[model samples]
Target: MHNRLHLTYANQSDQEYLSIYGKAKITENRQKVDDLWSSFLKVWFSGKDDPNLALLCVTIEDAYYWDQKNNKAVTIFKMAKAAITGEKSDTSDKGTLNI
Candidate 1:
């Protein structure tokens, strides 16, 4: 495990619309979510350099969106489990579990 990890949202030009919508902070928060996942991938796969252990990307749609960040966490956990146990992830309906 990494001793110290930093996460910050990287802003995009399109997010400027947030200001017009009075949702700048909300947009920034979503960027943080993306950053957190990116950071985790960096650490989780560090030093392994194994093609068999590559990380997979999972997409979550608004249809299942929730205020809590559990969606990402669940997807990550299920993927990890599937990799370790050599069984399909229970949380995902599709082969990759469209979280």
Candidate 2:
């Protein structure tokens, strides 16, 4: 089974909690929440082998960006793994970690 993870971005205002967690939990600026969701989707869905995973970003702005490739499943996977492992994966200078 694929592992799922939830990451939270720090410095989130009280308002940002609802969207990240739920309405009963808290809320945040609409635009900021949307941007955070967008970033998570960009990685979670774009990756191939779409493994079962969850990335809960608190700030979302910390997300790294590489060149706009047609599809960046490989890149996304590397980033996820790095996040989980707390160390950079075997990647070239450009951060392309060959799985």
Best by TM-score: 1
Query: Model 1 segments beyond 4 Å from truth?
Result: 1-70, 93-99
lDDT, candidates in the order shown: 0.38, 0.41
The residue ranges of model 2 lying beyond 4 angstroms of the native Cα positions read: 1-71, 90-99
Model 2 per-residue lDDT at 98 = 29
Give the clashing residue pairs of candidate 2, or none: 7-56, 9-58, 15-27, 15-28, 16-27, 16-28, 18-26, 18-27
Which has the greatest lDDT? 2
